[model samples]
Target: MKSAKQRFAGRYRAPGPKRSPLITPEGAAALKAELDDLWRNKRPVITQAVGEAAALGDRSENAEYIYGKKMLREMDSRILYLQRRLDRIKVVEGTPADPNRVYFGAWVTLVDDDDNERCYRIVGADELNPSSGFISIDSPLALALIGKQLDDRVELSDLDKGYEIIAIDYKSAAAE
Candidate 1:
């Protein structure tokens, strides 16, 4: 199995997995909002804390300095990540011109063999939140459900889990 470093190098380099243009306009706006919040509010708060912590300096054993610096590094990293992701993202707002087929931003309802029902919206990789009923377009379940329609039953025959797609509900409101 490929380690995380190998996977990152292979996947992020040129000619790697084609970046999916899957986010909706709303999703883009949401990402922008989060990035904005981080930069405007959170960054300054953390920066101030780090600066204050540094003033109490003992370079070797100051817990506040260590933790504050760590937090600043983490915040900067996340800000960079969001910026890079937003640059490569593509937003899909309305149902694709084809109303019959499933694509990004479509809400799909699935049923397992026992007739258990589950709903999910196909979204960008960055916005997947299973608890909130959103699934990444690049995920296995989304891959199986895409291009399918209502009343279509797709069998996800895999070793660990098996599921069926019974209904497809398109989300009119884009990802927020």
Candidate 2:
């Protein structure tokens, strides 16, 4: 009696491994700000829109009502995720225990075999911004670089290449 869509929806799918609970102070602040904005501003506006749209009647055919409901659901999902994530995360501020080695929140400069230089900041999963060279602490490159000192050579199996640590800098939350 089950439809194809209903059967497929219940199919087994492996859950992803849990992310590390470590986060930079800045990342934690950003998440908190986002959560506050969603709860205080976005949810209220969406609720009003949904109410107005529903007043038009025939929600099944009202595009405005449908779109508003969809958006409200998405917003609620994000708010819940943010709330749980923020609650579990531990904000890492100040400098690493070892100033000479690469660790979480370290800005690392690396040189490739071809002599090309690159820079990346090892941050939390919630703050990974590839375009700005911020990589997740759970990333393969960060794993390889963790506890590595400047001038240390790191082999990245994922990239099938090796890079040498050229510089390591730890900027505080204030500097960022």
Candidate 3:
């Protein structure tokens, strides 16, 4: 009994491609720490708050109780997502076999035609921070950079730009 519009919408909304389950060691550790904090600390605190709010008055009109319940649900949902993500992710340790080429966890330096230099670290999707120069491995730029060596030109047709690989280092740039 669905309308044509509804059927068209459902047919057009295809799922996105599956993301790779590879994660850097640091990224994995961060996720684990967050999951632990949620389960051991935040969850208990919210549960207690919800209990206290429920005891205060009638459930129907209780704003505090409703808010607490909503917060608890959000927290639980995030915890579940983290648990599942952690279970499937494979932590990539050390460096790539070919350190001279761009790969996951590599700090890459690129130069544009205008002589502008940019640096980025290819990392897991969960750890991407554009402002911090961390790019997800699934990103188009990272995909283009992968396996490319020094002095190699990478064409990004979508962005209408190209970059030359200037340097590739596996060491953590943040430490330096």
C-alpha RMSD for every candidate:
5.5, 2.3, 2.9
Q: Give the alpha carbon lDDT tens digit for every residue of 77-168 in model 2.
A: 99999999988999988896789999899999999999999999999999999999999999889989999998899997777899999999
Measured against the true structure, the TM-scores of the candidates, in listed sequence, are 0.80, 0.92, 0.90
Arranged by TM-score with the best first, the candidates are 2, 3, 1
Question: Given candidate 1, what's the lDDT at residue 122?
Answer: 82
lDDT, candidate 3, 40-141, per-residue tens: 999999999999999988999999899999999999999999999999999888877788888888999999989999999998999999999999999999
Candidate 1 lDDT, 42-99, residue by residue in tens: 9999899878888886856988888988988998999998899898887765667776
Q: Best-fitting candidate, measured by TM-score?
A: 2
Query: Which stretches of model 3 miss by more than 4 angstroms?
Result: 1-16, 173-176
Q: Model 1 compared with the native: what TM-score?
A: 0.80
Model 2 clash pairs? none
Higher-lDDT candidate among 2 and 3? 2
Cα misplacement distance, residue 156 of candidate 1 (Å): 1.1
Q: List ranges where model 1 is wrong by over 4 Å.
A: 1-19, 159-166, 174-176
The deviation in Å at residue 1 for candidate 3 is 6.2
